[model samples]
Target: MLKFAKYFFIVFLITAILPLVLMFAWNNSQMEKFHNAMAKSAMSTGLMRLEYSVKTNLKVQEGDILRKLYYILPNDKNLSHIKNILNDYNTEVIQKPIKTPVSFYERKNFDLYCVTLVPFDNSTKGLKISKPVSLDLLRPTGPYTIELRFNKDDAAYEFKNVAFDPMAFGPPKKIFLLLSRVAKPHYKENSRREIALKGEDNSNAAYLTIELAFGPFRGMIDSIFTSLIILLVGILSSFVIGLIIKRVFVTPVMALSKAADQVKKGNLNFKLDASSKIEIIKNLYENFNDMILNLQTKEKLRESFISNLTHDLRTPLVSQSQSLEFISQKFKEIGLTNEYELAESLAKNNEHLLKMVNLILDSYSFDPEKLKLSIEKADLYEIIEDCKEQLKPLLAEKNIEFVNNIYKGGTLIEADLFQIKRVFINLLSNAIDNTSGENKYIKAAARFEDEEVLITIEDNGNGIAKEDLKFIFDRYYSGKSLERKLGSGFGLSVCQKLIDMHNGQITVESEINKYTKFIITLPLSQHPGKGTKEQP
Candidate 1:
């Protein structure tokens, strides 16, 4: 989740937030440049007013030079009468030629306050020094400031008693006085400007200096707040996007991963929760569902092929067993009973083989169309007798006694003779496989009851577990594991299908290591309420 959140945040930054920052920077820079141009015009006007105050108003001329400083109020008009203002006794202190011509000072008064300077030329000089200007113009009681210097060499001025000054407040870390030669100096805000002092006249009056300031600091402050808002929004959006990503992308993908694991474990029937609001995941889910269905179809086809192939293999074995039976009888007629025994053993084994083959085929033969039963009237007891005879070798091998108690009267059943015989043989063989110990016996009896034939095959053998009896009729479900390898786990399954086709029901009852009984109820056609035309 954290990984997804991280990636989502990055994507949001690139796709959504980056443009906001770029646009803000570009606009802030452009506005600052435009403000500088406007400030220059305003400063040009201030310079004109100062030049008029010096040249036409004060009107002192030729070689009038002095070097002394004094603070004067703007209302003081005595500046027009003061003589040799620059060439006074202070001028004799260090007589030298004055190269720089223009000068100015910070203007702070009862009704007005402004920025003192921005960027100025080297040829300009500082000839005027004004009182300290308060920067907290929005506050009634504000910090005081003053510029204290008179040099034209560097055109740089130093200030005293800034509001944040440590001497007056707390600690002093550092202060900023100048900016380098990039574009603007010191600052570029609506609250600050650059002042330039220049004129054509010299010594006529106070130096004609121009004072201006850059734009205010509010624009920069607004930009900073905008950036902070964008940062906050970007962070908030990152978390929301992270959750969306987990739902739309991560969740479904993990489900698919678990589905893959199920498939690997051969669970083709494991269903996927493919529902989704995302278009891409919906498509993927549909494709995966199709894939699982295809695999099931393929598996069914493979099972059907093997089952049918087993049926084909059983036909030749049946014929070979009949041939061996005929040969065994001929040998017995010649009093060669020892030679006849081998032929009889092979014939019975062939019968067992046919029963197993049929069981294998029936396991997969769920469709009634695949059965192809040729319904005809046949003696049920006679078929049971024949199936018993076919399994005589296995019975003898286990020393088990087989009792056939099916009635010889009204023993007619409208059933597929071949399939009926297969079922009878399968039941007898299964009993023989399970029968063990001395005096092991299996009994088959049939009786007419309520227009149906009740045929039961009971055995005193290694009986089935009660839990296993219920699943005995399921395809490939064995009553006991002992008979599993020999019987293919499909004897009772095949019997149940054959009985169902005859419109009859088959059931079993058992107790472990005691007795097992299988009851088959087949509808009799020739009996009172039953008829061949109606069904089995």
Candidate 2:
């Protein structure tokens, strides 16, 4: 039972589980790689958005600086209104500055509301601005100069200070301070002050780091678990399916195997009880029944052969015994004077025994391998002429007319000359014996086709029955003989065997009471160097 289970398990693994497992592993791995790549791409796209926002903000700020400069130098009322409009624009459109708490500080002893405009410069070029100088005093009817200072970098910018309501420009000091602190740690001590004014520098890098750590990493974990669960479900389903298939299919096969074993042990009486739903098993069962029927047929043939052998042997023996008894009684009466008559009787019985023994030997020689053929290149027409001449005496005794149509140019074929001559002789003899009329005739013809030679011997004699034609070449098959005497029934079988040896063929076409024609076809050469075998 363990052996049977092991066999089924191996089959299951090969046919079902192994393929499914490999596919699951391969698909799961690909899904994992796909999820990881998707998460990484999403994070990269988000970082690109942040960088684009920063660059856009810098462009807006540069435009604002240029507008402010125009308003100071020209002191145009139109320029002042433009600055007011710029201040009303949303902060998101300008830059991504930090949101900070709004705070108000009053400068001590300054009657002029000291509105400090933090000079925003993103350039790294070295330039300096001195303390405040009156621009109107220098140019008369122009803007005043305001001092801008960076305490850490010791850099200052003196820009024209135009008078306006500080309330119009919202307080950006708290927002700037918060942005500066966040931005400072990313730069060197000396560069921090420069970078603080340009708020676009370090904001993009911080957002990219946050997205990678939080968003994509969480997605990777979720994708891994999902793929693993799918793989587990596939494996479990394959196992269940394989188990059910083994029970349905393998069980029937095993039962058949056991039945076969019992049959081999000489138990032909055993019958299989395992009925299966599989088509293959059903076919096997039918074939097993056919095998048993064939075995029974063979046993019957064996018994028949033994019984026939006894009857055949007894007939000849009984005839010889009666001949001996007659010869003894005659010798006692005539006192052995008429010796010649006694000798003739003994010779007749001896000839009968000799013929039986020769028939048995000829049956053995009908084996293809046992017959030694003297194969050579010879004229097939010449061989047919020789056969006609040798059998002329027999034809004359029967007053039968012989017709010869040996083809011109004499067809050449490579064949066993002596064996082919014997084939013709046997066919001609059978024809002579079967012919009945005084006008009995035998027609022998030869023709040559491309690559092959054909020789036919046709007789206007009593033909064979349709049912008897099929078994005519079987050993010892003698159909209704016209003479009512049995010749050894091995002639046609010998012809078939010899033709097969030469890689040629023999066939008989006959209709009852019409005529029988024997057609033999041989190749142009049967050289030992060019041996051939019969096609299956």
Candidate 3:
């Protein structure tokens, strides 16, 4: 049980640790991917914000003052009047703009405006204002023209004479600033743009630098820490679970191991007190008990075999020795020239010895491989006939009636002919020996069924007991008492082994004091590869 527990612990340890390691590795890889995506998104959002700030500030500077004026005006002007008013305002604002003084601080209040004009009549619509507009207004009627205008010192300037170009701003700040911010020692020329818009009096420029702040690093760290904490908790939980399992399952198994060791050392009385809650441990306990029972049975059989062997050997020896003594005494009483009587005594002793030796040899040769058989295609009826002929003298002596019921077409079977003949002879002899009553009879029959031949040998003898029938084919297992005139207990066992070698089977049916039947079935000249008819 302890050994099993140790192995289980090792398995649990490996199972628990491997997944955590894999999770940690996977977490690291996923973290890297997440961090990369966050970084890219942050960079993109930052760039978009920078562009939006520039456009928004420029629009605010341009529209704030003009929108106020447009809201104040009443809608009373014709197309020509509106154009002239816008043209006059543009000239006034641009021409008088020297009052505010262009400077870096004041540039925040500056603006640019763009306008597109559409004609009320839809004719002569190609005319667009050529000048860049800080603020633009449209005339509401006729083939109208777009006008760019801006305010300075409560006066508006309109650039009516200038032509509009899409790139008329001349790099934005250069047209408006008076000085370059990059000319300062602390300013980086490539890192930010600097411009000076030329004016009649002064110019101003401010650097617009692009800088990126690390936003996702903190988020990345937080995610990593969270993942690590989750993984740690999972690993700890798994370890605790594994430990609990080992205690509940492994401990009982270890107990079984110690008990098994005691059993191996011949301590059959050893018992395990381990908890039976575990199915494996309970199964082990049952198997251990069964093994002990089998061992005890084997020990009893060994003792019986030894006693039987001794008795059998002693019987033959005593018979031979007594016969020799009787012969010597008879010879003295009769004459030295009595050759016939001397020969009879000698033959009787030799026969007893031969019978004992043959029984011993038969027991040894009951092994299936040891009995080499000459197998061939032989007629089942012919073998049966031969066996009957050989047992005819014995039948006559015992006054036993013999009946043979062989099929019309002799059943042909592929088998070891010599071994099968021995089988038939043994069965017949066993029946003859056991037969009693004045009308003692034996019956042998063969019939074909479903591509196989079934042979049955039955006799009107004292039938086998129900208990003994189960073990009739066991080695040295004679159903009859030892005192009976039966040969060695190997006959049925040998027959069973021989039949098994030919891929055949034998069965028996018997009733006490009525009859005993031995049924043998063999494939009729059919190999295993050859298909047989299905039995109904």
Candidate 4:
């Protein structure tokens, strides 16, 4: 399920976020292209307008020169050369100039530029101009109009016929380079066009060429900022969507998984707390709760049935055991040889049966309330001796040696005497069952360790395998051995439970074909709050 959630998150992010990212990239590219094209167009339009204005100013200047020559001194021989130049101007005058010679003429809105002007042959004298005119005084109408201020030292200079050197203007404005970059191939220096002005005779035409400087538009979109914002929004949206998905789907499934684990570990009382908004998950949680409840009911019924059945079978088996013992005694008294042997054999079999029945009742009919301990100071050495004496018949049958290494006086411990004795009996019985070959021996030892008594039961006969040690005390987990298989597999589980009631620990260690040892540690005295009904 965790893998499924991860897979789902990856697939969802791809589907929800991939297309948006692609679209943003493509749109940003297209927008950049469009903005560049628009900037180029704007630059071209600026250049065209500059060129048209320069041409119009040049025509006006030519008309003013011609009017001064044709009407002001039409027949003056000294200015006849000027008339001849006016006749060769090769352009119609668009502006109406005064018939009389104007003292000073200033056309501040003119945009045409030239390094030198040749109005006529060398015989004609040039017109006088004022000192130091600003270069920007020529073109005053445009999106970007530059006014070049004259320095104090430059104001001493003068020009002829309003003509000035282009060098004195210095380098062009910084904006021209930016404009050129944006326009590129469309607005280069070579693209500048010269206008031809012709007279009525259409001969000896004068030419006007002007350098055009385009203006820049610094209004391009900020694609980086926009892309960042798009990316941020995309991430935030994906996170919100992913969170919703996990909350609505993944969380409930994880809860169900945890609850299922608890149930697998034999905890039927665990209930899932699923409050899902999704309908299907809600139904699933409800069904899971119902299943657990049903199992609990059936488990209780099965336990009750086992309890009643064990009780019913225990009564008859106990009675049969007593009757068989009496019949064996009576047959022995008559000394009916073969019949007496049969009775003894029957008595042995009946005794074994009775033990099996009692084991079932003790193991299966477990009620925690009825299994409370009778906590008191008990003699540990006495318990070990009693277990040994009770299993003496089996020890004699197998010819196995029993070694008790406890201090003879007695070792005292706070525990339930009956449960502690049962623990020892179970450990010894297990040791005896596994120790069957020649030179078989069982050893019991105890010692004081801090505030606890450490007791061990060891057997020298074919020891338990290394792999079976961990599960030796688990319910119904008898090891793989011929003698181990002969009895019901609940003895060690019962021993472990009884030890836990005394707040003690039981552990086992073994090596294949060497020896098996069961170690038990019990507190010398129970804790202050521990009582007969203490819960472990």
Best-fitting candidate, scored by lDDT: 4
lDDT, candidates in the order shown: 0.58, 0.56, 0.57, 0.62
TM-scores, each model vs. reference: 0.38, 0.37, 0.38, 0.51
Q: Higher lDDT: candidate 1 or 2? A: 1
lDDT of 1 at 44: 51
**Pairing residues by index, what is the TM-score of model 3?**
0.38
- After aligning candidate 2 to the native by TM-score, how far in Å is the CA of 189 from where it should be? 88
What's the number of clashes in each of the models?
18, 2, 23, 5
Winning model by TM-score: 4
lDDT of each residue in 1-536, candidate 2, tens digit only: 44877887888677766776676556545655665565455444544444444344444444554554444433332433544544633111122222321111112232111111222222212111112222222211211122223333342333333444321232235544453343222111211111122212222111111122222233333444454466578768877887776677666667777777766543566666535666777778878877867866775585467446645775776677677767767776777856746755675566556545555555544446455676776776688778889878678878888888876457778777787887887788788877767677989887778877777888887887777777677666776645322256677778888888888899988876678899988888664633332222
The better candidate by TM-score, 2 or 3, is 3
- Write model 3 residue lDDT over 30-82, tens digit each, in one string: 76666556545544454455445444544553344244335323343244544
Answer with 1 or 2, whichever has the higher TM-score: 1
User: Candidate 3 — what's its lDDT?
Assistant: 0.57
